[model samples]
Target: MKNVSTREPGLHKGVLYAMLAAALFGASTPFAKVFVGQVAPVSLAGVLYLGSGVGLLACFLVRALVQRGQVGQPVALTKPDLPWLAGAIAAGGVAGPVLLMVGLSMMPASSASLLLNMEGVLTAMLAWFVCKENFDRRIFIGMLLIVAAGALLSWEQVPVLGVPWGAFAILGACLCWAIDNNLTRKVSASDPLQIAMVKGLVAGIVNIAIALAFGYALPGAGTALAAGAVGFCGYGLSLVMFVLALRHLGTARTGAYFSAAPFVGAAISLIMLAEAPGATFWIAAALMGGGIWLHLTESHGHEHEHEAMEHLHAHSHDGHHQHEHDFEWDGSEPHAHPHQHVPQRHAHPHYPDIHHRHRH
Candidate 1:
């Protein structure tokens, strides 16, 4: 077996990225809620995602111009990444936001924001069970608490004959996003900005076409501009950070960190919309907070073996990447190029990051 030495960076950076992603996305909820009455749900969703796409496209172009001839550059997306990207756009970009806008129209912004927590729970479940990502009792317990909190949010004191369509719609949105998260993870090692931009553009265009076909009229320029701004910051920038977090933290942990988004949105909803929630909301918040705390404090490490592998991503000459370059002598610390990993064995603390996805 080839030797495998490694430089283990702390996960604090990933934690920070996840938190920032949460903040941006969370804050978008109340803003979106404000637009419900002014614009049709599907049309509003299209505007938000379109704004994300257009804004990121401009940023991506500027970065490309500035980074020309730079020694270290992120890898571009490959053709193989298309299917995953398409799935993500379809599920998250198109379906998720449309469902959310519809649900937001039917419920209080605060309640809808809290209901969005179900995305984290669903994401973790799919990551652990379907994607074969590793998890422990602590993670499981945290998921349970989050699920319970969602149940409380969906609970109704007065029985209604029909189903709680609003809550169900939000839950549907969560499931779509959960699927998108896993699909996006497959391409996380690629250029995150490009991935997000592409997703936003495709989703935006498709949804806009959908809205137009449904005879929905576009909102005024002012409302459109506001929605776009929210989309650029919340959906576009937030997704870029989220992809980076997935690169370092894996799906479940990143989803767990992102769970804080609901609280952020709920707080904003209370302040912006001045909607006071009842005792159930507070109790649900406490339970969800406890669950998030459990995930935040989790640590995992062990002795593990690495089989030979080959791929590309940004990297430095750390312990994990001690190989010869076939070309160039600039000697950049972190550059992207195709390289191979020789089979080796080692022990260390790690997340199920791109490289650390070995058998548990």
Candidate 2:
């Protein structure tokens, strides 16, 4: 029997990654809202994602130069990873942002940001039922709380932009991203930066083409640059961190933690725009915060069996890792290489991590 003992380390680390991704992406919402005045909605979406793609591509180029002869490139994406990446770009990059930008154009940033929690609920549901990711009842309860919070955000006395159309647009955006989240999981083992960059590039190009077809004039360079900067942090860096969390936490859990993003955006929007949050906002915040706490503190422990598995990612010689090398190992504690997990049964706390996906 093998054990990846001390579940706190992995759980805490994955939570940290998810929160950071949330913060980055959430903060981008209000900022993107502000930029809506500077360009067409679709154009702004394109630029933001374009910036993310270009910035990450540059980082990857530098990384390659620095590790030209490295024995392992943990951040490299292969051909097998492309299909998932394409779907993520199409759903998340292209459709999601266009809907979000259009929604932001009509709704208050605070309201829009709060409504964005829908993505987590949708993502979790898809992961739990559709993807067949193993999870317990607690996750479902947390999902309900998040869904309730999202519903609260959609309450408007009078729906502008065509009778609650804005709120509906944001919900549509959430669905697109939910699909993207599931698709991205298929390639989560690959380099996250590479996946994000490709998604950004393809999505940016598609959205930009659509916007140009609509006859939106190019915005000033300053506006374009600012949107790009937002994209680099909110989309590029956030996605890289998100993929890291996904590798450790699985799709549903990762989305649950990422529910924190909209809160960050709401706080920033209130401060930046001097808008007030009403009763519904505070109520929704409490529900979401509670749900996020539940996911964060969760620890799944059971005597689960590990089927013989072979894959590669960043790792150390934890108890669960008991593989001999085909080549001379560099004798490092933590390294990335092809290793196999012999069948084992042990009782320990775990998540549905890359190694721990077993029947519950």
TM, every model:
0.88, 0.88
Kindly list the per-residue Cα lDDT of model 1 for residues 25-67, writing each as its tens digit: 9899778878988988888888998999999999999999999
Determine the C-alpha RMSD for candidate 1 after optimal superposition of all C-alphas.
Answer: 3.2
Q: lDDT of all predictions, in order shown?
A: 0.84, 0.81
So what's the TM-score on candidate 2?
0.88
Which regions of candidate 2 deviate over 4 angstroms?
A: 1-6, 9-11, 98-116, 150-172, 274-281
In model 1, how many backbone clashes occur?
0
What candidate 1 gets wrong by more than 4 Å, as runs, is 1-11, 98-116, 146-171, 273-289
lDDT of 2 at 37: 69
Residue 143, candidate 2: how far off, in angstroms?
Answer: 2.6
Show the lowest summed lDDT stretch of 10 residues, model 2: 153-162
lDDT tens digits, residue span 195-251, model 2: 888887888888889889988876688888888999999989999999989988899
